[model samples]
Target: MVLKIALIGAGLIGREHAKLISSNPRVQLEAVADISEAGKVLADEYGTRYFFDVREMLDATKPDGVIIALPNAFHAEAAMACIERGIPSLVEKPVADTLEAAMQLTEAVERKGVPVLVGHQRRHSPDIAKARQLMNEGALGRLVAVNAMWLTDKPTNYFDAAWRRQPGGGPLLINLIHDIDCLRFICGEIESVMAFSSNEVRSFEVEDTASISVKFTNGALGTLLMSDTAVSPYNWDTAAGQALYFPHQPENTYVFAGTKASLALPLMDFWRHENENSHWQHPLLRQHITLDGSRAYENQLHHFLDVIEGKAEPIVSVRDGMLTLATILAITKAGKEGRIINVADMLG
Candidate 1:
């Protein structure tokens, strides 16, 4: 039984999802909506119908599922539209720009009782899944601090795209939201946040770098460092006008510290040991875990279909999206105000 899928937005990530869904034997790319010529090109490449307006596509194709891969600011409107029509949708991350918007989108999903999953692809990584399983099984002992770093440089052409340089469209919102979701997925719910953010590079309207500390409800503290102005060997040259490649940084890395052990995820590498004793040992793990290099996005799509078919529960729930956004905003507020901020209160 092939699930007819409608893709709303044909941007970089949208094309990636389209490739995965079209390749799946259990899924069929039925229709796509994007105002850009790139969207039409992607639809044609996947042998699917294309529409310039998403609402029109939703009405015409009436697909079993929809992938809302529009920009961060547009997520809420697109997702609310899907759930209101009783169509299951998997939206790309940050869910929405603000907590209020996120709550609205989530509430629609709840009132309509439709399967709407946020795209936090890291939850689907084989290594990430295994790490979470191990952690759950007490391999990591008590969960402690989660330190995540995202550093890179973008080309001037990156801001050439209109929306990316606008307010609410910065590294903290546009990119770190994925890291924020991953931290929430692995560590725990954030209780409060303290942040410091500034535009140190590109002289754009949006912030380019940030340093945030989080207090999780589980009593675990986390620090996230995000910047779009670091040039390193591991960098994949993601600057706009460059060759298209992976959606994330080539040298993706994450560190999770617990009472018993600590783990590191650097690109395809995963490392863990007993406490801080072996911190410097066993540096090299492997090249990459097998089984579909795009597992994160693929699994996100698969899980959405499962919920629509009543076969499984959502991987990332609506509450998760709301809490994560609240945490992020709390961080931004703290950074701007130069003080610690309570995430829960901010959400309320």
Candidate 2:
């Protein structure tokens, strides 16, 4: 049986989801909802119906599942609507704008006993999944420290939107959140964070650069550097060749150091001592790990279908997404307050 899917919002990411849905033979793009004319245009192009009101579209199409790709602030409300109707949904990342709203949506899903998937597409990447497996298997040997970077030069035209210069609009929230989620997925939960941010480059209300220090619950230390003003190619999206929009630069953007070995991400270059001795006399050997390629968004759609069909559980649940958001928020708070912020305190 083909699953009918309704898409909420017709923005860039929403349209991408619509394209993926249309490409999947097992799913039908039944209807789309958006406040802009793009919704109708996308619907007409895809041979589907369109509505300005989400509720009206949901009622008219009665799709088996929905993909919520609305703005961050509208996530909880639209997701709650679907949960209330027992319609499974795959909500885009950062779950909601605020912690309280995210909690409310999660509670509603629990109370209604409906399935919801959080869209952290990196978890579906084969390289990331393999790294996670190796980490869990102790291949890295008790991870000690990690270093990550998300440095890129976003064109000035990208910030033409008013909100892009506002307080909540910056590389920390817009880009770094993905890396934070991937770190949390591969490493353990972050216990605390301290950070410093600057807007010296663009002088916008949002920061253009940030340096963060994090402590994991499992006694691991991590350092992260992010900048939207840097003209570099040290980001997961570009380095890993995930999307077509960016030029693929095969460089390592993350480093995980452990007692036994150190691993560089995306490149998957493993370094270890050739001998059992931990002395400076031994030379370290480098081993390259290769993984098959797959489109993360397409894999995410398949997982969402499995979740709707009850064949698989959500890879990134509502609670997990909320924690990732809280972690990023904690970093932002730490940068502003010039002190350490506990992840648990933010949740409370």
Each candidate's lDDT (Cα)? 0.76, 0.90
Taking all chains together, each candidate's TM-score versus the true structure is 0.86, 0.97
Which stretches in model 2 have alpha-carbon errors above 4 Å? Answer: none
Regions more than 4 Å wrong, model 1: 233-244, 247-252, 267-294
Q: Cα RMSD (Å) per model?
A: 4.2, 1.2
Poorest lDDT segment (10 consecutive residues) of candidate 2: 274-283
What tens digits encode model 2's per-residue C-alpha lDDT throughout 1-348? 999999998988998998899889999999999999999999999999989999988888889999998877788899998987889999988788888998898788777789889988999988788889889999889999999999989888898867678866677877899899999999989999999999999999989999999999999999999999998989998999886368888899999998888899899999988776764677889999888778788889999999999999899999899899899999999999999999999988
Candidate 1 lDDT tens digits, 1-348: 888999988887888888888668888999989999998899889887989998999999889988888988889999888887898888888788878899887777777788788777667766567667766787667888787776777778878778888877777777787778777776767788888888867777878888888888888888888788876433212311111364543454666777766666644343455335555654533334333344455677778889778898778877677777787788778988999898778867
lDDT of 1: 0.76
How many residue pairs clash in each candidate at the backbone level?
0, 0
